[model samples]
Structure formats: C-alpha cells, structure tokens
Target: MENFTPSISVSSQVTHSLLARLLALAYVDQEVDLREVELIYGIALERGVSKETLESIMLRPHSVSTILPSTPHERVSHLYDLARLILADGIIKEEERAMLRRSVLLYEFTEENADGIVDFLLEQAQAGVAPAQVIQVVQESI
Candidate 1:
C-alpha cells in the first residue's frame, strides 16, 4: 500500500469524540495502560489537538459528543486509529473488540461488511502495518 495522507478536515467535535472513544477503549481492561495513553496522545497531537483539550477530554469524556466523520476515508481512518490503540498494549480484550464492532456500525459501514472490516483492521494492526497503509488498503477494497 502506498502512503496515504487524509486531507479531510474534521470538526473539534469529531476529534474529541474519537479521543473519547480511545479513552473508553483504553480503560476496557479496567486499567489504563501507558501505551494506550501514549498512542491516543500521539494521535491527538497529529490532528493538531491541544494537550489541554485532550487533558480536558480525559477528565470528562462525557462532555464530548459522539460525532462520526462524514466521509468514508475519514471514517476508515478513525477506525484504523482505534484499531492501533487496541493493539498498543499487546492485548486484545473482549471489550475492546466489542467497541470496535460498535464503532463499525456507528461509522455507517454495512452490517455485511462490519465483521470482515473489523477483523481485517485488527489483523493489520497486529501485523504492525502503518495506519495510513491500513486505511489505504481498506479504501481500495471499498
């Protein structure tokens, strides 16, 4: 897969929502791992989100609206990022998998494709594929 740079600009709501979801996933095991925090922080930084804003969301994820991105690329990008966060701690908890499945529906992927997409994303993340490459592969298949 070639390099992919998502050109879409998402609202602050979307970014916060994604971060909030990441936070939720990180705590699925009942403890927040350092790796998970680092991954989420890195993602936030890459998207130009402020540390203060991320800290605020960390303090209160409920304040962030669950706004999904409008475009397929943006949706897949967010999903891939979530997949990466799931694999950050080198463990795949049942709760984390459940969250990814729920996210597929929230992202508007058809039910028929949701399981396969989630499986593929997890496989790619486990194999250590870059998020951009994983997003590109999924987009091409779509």
Candidate 2:
C-alpha cells in the first residue's frame, strides 16, 4: 500500500483539505508517489472533515482553489511553495516541471521570483531542513 499519511498539521479547513487532496492527486504515479484515494481518507480523518465533503471537492474537474486566492500575493505565495516542493528533490520529472511552470505562470510570479524560490528550496532541502520547517515555510509563504 502507498504511504498515504495525511499531513497532521492540516486541520478541518476546507480549503486546506482541498489543496492537500489536489496535490496528493498530482503526486499519483510519480517516482515519489502519493496515494490519492488514501490521502483523501487520511486528510478527512486528520482534519475531521467529512468524507462526503472531500468527495464533493474531488469531483471538480479542476482544482477549485486555483481561482479562490483572496489576493495576488497570496496566490503567488502558494505558487512559490508549490514550486519549491516540486523541485526540492533536484530531479523534477517532466510532468512535475510542467505543472510548476504553468502554476508560476498562472500565479503571475516573475521569472526572478520563481527562480529565487526554487533555489531557496533546493538549498534548504540540501541542508536537510525538517519536514516541519518545510511545512512552516508553506504555511507562512501562503
């Protein structure tokens, strides 16, 4: 079975749950795979979000959170953190790379800003930053 550990930090926030599910789906079948279905179960349990609630969100064709950013800065921040994760392992697969590129474009991050965030994540990962630190960065950045 896949390691579908729902991040313990994400609590009953619908938006957070939705994003976690979407990311988990994106990670499906990758070299570093995530179990999309199991992740759904895990997040619902961790966050106390009902399974039905997550099921509804999962039915959407596109991720709803993409357009729900409250501000441009907020969107950019999410993009930065996502890009950081996508590139953290140093060898971004083609699919992951394309996703990051499009996300940066959609979030309107400048080339310089994107590069800076990517480099920062690479450095941090190389230095063996803890998962808690990485999660903190994502929460703060967004």
Candidate 3:
C-alpha cells in the first residue's frame, strides 16, 4: 500500500485549542510575559482565530479543554511550539514543567515519554536549533 498523508485543516477549534494550551502554559509561571502573549496572538491571528475569541480564551485558558491534534505531525508541531513558548520568557519554571505534563496528558502523548520530549525540545531550543530541525528530530524520535 502506498503511504498517504491527509492534510490537516487549520480550523478555528484547532487554533483556539492550541493557543489555549500555550496560554495556560504561559500563565503557569504566574507572570505572563508580553513576548509570550505576542507569540500566541501572532499564531492565533495567522491561524484565523478571531481576536475576540483569542482574548476570551486568553483570559480563561484553564477553562478551555485543548483539542488534541489527530496526526503525529500535528502533535509534534504543537509540542514544538509549546517548547518555544517555554523558552520565550527566558525562564522555564517548575510550574511550567508541571503544566507541560498536563498538556502532554491532554494531548495524549505517552506519559512516560512526556518529560523526555519536553527535555529534548528545551535542549534543542536552548541550542538555537531551527524549528524544522527540531520537528524533524522529534518525529524521528517518536
């Protein structure tokens, strides 16, 4: 059988869920940095999430249940971006780590491998690795 890849549609639910998870992570440290907010807003805007919806979700991200991406690539992509957000404010607090675990569970990533995945992403991000490379390595690892 020929390998087939179905394109993942960027729906408003996906965008909102992605941002909500990121926003929840951002708030984990108890200090939402402007840079982090900017990144989330930028992504939300690009993904066609309404400003109003983004604001609402941003205000109460904990209330939003993240809609996990269905594909491997989508999962890795979201995890990569979450890693970026973790490093955005120049701090990765313990609180953020806890939040990432919740996100991993929410995304249905293997519980045992969740820490390893976050650690990998943090190492790559700290080394200034390209996003594409990070995703590629993550995909390979998975």
Best by TM-score: 1
**Of 2 and 3, which scores higher on lDDT?**
3
Q: What tens-digit string does per-residue lDDT give for candidate 3 at 31-86? A: 87999988788767766777898898867777766577778777777777787788
Mark the regions of model 1 whose C-alpha exceeds 4 Å error after superposition.
Answer: 1-10
lDDT for each of the candidates? 0.88, 0.53, 0.77
Instruction: Tell me the tens digit of each residue's lDDT in model 2 across 1-142.
Output: 8898674332234355345534643564354433334544553555466677667666663544434355554454444445445544445566665566556655566776775655565556446565456656766766
**Residue 23 lDDT, candidate 2, scale 0-100:** 60
Judged by TM-score relative to the true structure, which candidate is superior, 1 or 3? 1
Name the candidate, 1 or 2, with the larger TM-score value.
1
Model 3 regions lying over 4 Å from their true place: 1-10, 50-52, 59-63
C-alpha lDDT (0 to 100) for residue 8 of candidate 2: 31
TM-score of 2: 0.47
- Look at candidate 2 and tell me the lDDT of residue 45: 54
Ranking by TM-score: 1, 3, 2
RMSD value for candidate 3: 7.7
| Colliding pairs, model 3 | none
Winning model by lDDT: 1
TM-score of each: 0.89, 0.47, 0.78
Q: Give candidate 1's TM-score.
A: 0.89
The residue-level lDDT of candidate 1 at 73 comes to: 90
